[model samples]
Target: MKNLKKYAKAIILLTVIILLVCFSFYKISKSRSSQFFGGLTSHVNTEEKIIALTFDDAPTEYTNEILEILDDKNVKATFFVVGKNFEKYPLEGEAIIENGHEIGNHSYSHQRCIFKSQTFIESEIEKTNTLIHDHGYKGEITFRPPNGKKLFGLPYYLNKNNIKTIMWDVEPDTYVSGDADAIVKYTVENTKPGSIILLHPLNGTAGEADREALPKIIDELKAGGYSFVTVSQLLKYEN
Candidate 1:
C-alpha cells in the first residue's frame, strides 16, 4: 500500500512539473517584449514624439486604398506581409515598394513558430525575404512573426540571419476588434512617444475597423504632436 501511495505521489509531481514547463513555454512564445534568443524590439525608448505604424498580413487588392490614404496623409508606415500573399499579388507588393514604405516578413505560411523545425523556420523567412526583394523592396527587411508568436527556432534563425524581430507596444484594434471608434479612442489614448502601433487593415474582419481608424488615429495623433515613421526609421531614433 505504501509503495502504491509513493508511486501516486511521484506521478502527481511529474504531472505538475510538466504543466509548469508547458506554461512557461506558452508565456515565452506569446511575450511581446522578450525572447529566449536574439533581439526583440516592441517599442523604442526616446523622448521624440515619433511612432511607427505597422500593418500585418497581405498586400491584397485593397492595398491601393491604404496606399492612397498614406499618400494623402504623407505618412510612411511599415508592412509585414506574408510571402504567399506578396507573390500572389506582386503588383500590390510593388505598389508598396513604389510608395517608399518599409516591408517586413510575416512568414510564408503564417504558422506558429514554436516547436517548429529549424529547416522549416529558415524556409519560411528566407522565402518571404526573396519575395520581398522580388517585389522591388530595396530596404532592410525586418521580421514580425505571424500573430506575434515565436519561441525557439524562429528567434534563433532570425538571430543567425541578423534580422530584427519587430513587435508592437500599441495595439488598439486588437483590443476592440470590429469597432473603429473604439480603436481610434484606444490608440489616441494609449500611444506614447516612440511607440510602435500594430494595425491590420489588410485581412480579416478587424481590417475594416482598422482601416477606418487609421485616418482618425493619424489625425488625432498629429493633433497630439505625434509624427509617424516607418519601423526602421523609428528604430533609428531608439537610444
Candidate 2:
C-alpha cells in the first residue's frame, strides 16, 4: 500500500510538469514576433524615411470614404483583405486596385493559425490568394495571420515558399479609442523611418469612427513627410 501511494504521487507530479511545458510552448508558438523556427519580423531596420500603411479585413462599406482620403493625400496603402470579404465586396476590392493601391492575403475565414495542420494552413492561404487575384490585384500578396498568432504550420509553409509575413510597428486603434484625431496623432508621433502602421478601417461594424480616422491618419503622416509604401515595397529596406 505504501509503494502504490508513492507511485501515484509521482505520476501526478509528472503529469503536472508535462502540462506546464505544453502551455509554455503554446504561448511561445502563438507569439507574433517569436517562433521556434524561421525569422519573425515585426519591424524593419532601415534609415530611409519611408513607411507602409496596411489595413486589414474588408473593403467594407466605408471603402469609398477611405479611398477618397488616400486619393486626396496621394497616398497608396496595402489592404490585407480576407477572402470572404473580397467575395462580398468584389466591386470594392476592384476599386482599391484601380486606384493604384496594393492588396494582400488575410486568409479565407480569418482563422487563427495556431496548432493547425499543414493542409489547413495551405487552404487558408491559397484560397485567399486566389480571391486576391480574382479582385484584379496583380502584386505580391503577403500574409498577415489573423490576430497576429501563428505557429509551426504557418511558419513552415511561409518559409518554405519564401512568402514574407507582414506585421506592424505602430497600431493606432490599439492605443486610441479609434477616433480620427487620436489615430492621426498616434501615427504622426510614433512613426519613424521604415515603420509599418496597421489600421483596421475596413470593417463596417467598427462604425464611422474608424472610417473618419483614415484620412486624418493619412494627412498627418503626409504632413510629417513620411512616404507611404506597400508591404512589398517596404521589404526593399529589409537587411
Candidate 3:
C-alpha cells in the first residue's frame, strides 16, 4: 500500500510538470516579441510620428477595395500574403505590387508553425517567397507567421535565412472584431510613435469592420501627424 501511494504521488507530480511546460510553450508560441531564435520585431523604438500598417492573409477578393482605400489615403502598407491565396488571386497580388506596396510571406499552407518540422517550415516560407518573387515584388521580403504562431523550427529557419519575424504592437481588430467604431477607437488610442499596426481587412465578410476601420484609422493617425510606411521602411527607423 505504501509503495502504491508513493507511485501515485510521483505520477501526479510528473503530470503537473508536463502541464506547466505545455502552458509555457503555448504562451511563447503566440508571443509577439519573444521567440526561441531569430530577430523579432513587434514594434520599432523611435520617437518619430511614423508607423507601419500591415495586413495579414492578403490577396482575397477584398484586396482591391483595401488598396483603393490606401491609394486614396496615399499610404504604403505591407501585405503578408499566403502562397496559395496569392497563386489563386494573381491579379489581386499584382495589383498590390502595381500600386507600390511591400509584400511579406505569410507561409504557403497557413498552418500553425509550432512543433512543426524544419523541412515543413522551410518549404512553407520558401514556397511563399518564390510566389512573391514570381509576382514581381522586388523589395525586402519579411515574414509574419500565420496566426502569429511560431516556435523552435520556424524561428530557427528564419534566423538561418536572416529574415526578421514581423509582428505588430497595435492589433485592434483582435480586441474589437466586427465593430468599426471600436476598432478605430482602440487603434487610435493604442498607437504611438513607431507603432506597427496590424489589420485583416481582406478576410472576406468577416473582415468588413476591419475594412471600414482602415480608412478611419489612417485618417485619425494622419490627423494626429503620423506618416504611414511599409514594414521595410519602418525597419529603417529602428533605433
Candidate 2 lDDT over residue span 1-239, tens digit each: 99999999999999999999989878876565777657766677888888998888867777887888788888888888888888888899889999999888788889898889999999999988988886677888788888887777888998887777877888877788547787778878998988888887776656456677777777766777778887778888976
lDDT of 3 by residue, 1-239 (tens): 99999999999999999999999999999999889997899999999999999999989999999999999999999999999999999999999999999999999989998888998999999999998998788888999999999979999999999998999999987788899999999999999999999999999877899998999999999999999998889889988
**Candidate 1 or 2, higher lDDT?**
1
lDDT of 1 by residue, 12-88 (tens): 99999999999999999999888989989999999999999999996887799999999999999999999989878
Q: Give the deviation of candidate 3 from the true structure as CA RMSD.
A: 0.9
The stretch of ten residues in a row with the least summed lDDT in candidate 3 is 169-178
Q: Rate residue 59 of model 1 by lDDT.
A: 87
Question: RMSD, each candidate, Å?
Answer: 0.9, 2.4, 0.9
Candidate 3 clash total?
Answer: 0
Report clash pairs, candidate 3.
Answer: none
Q: In candidate 2, which residue pairs clash?
A: none
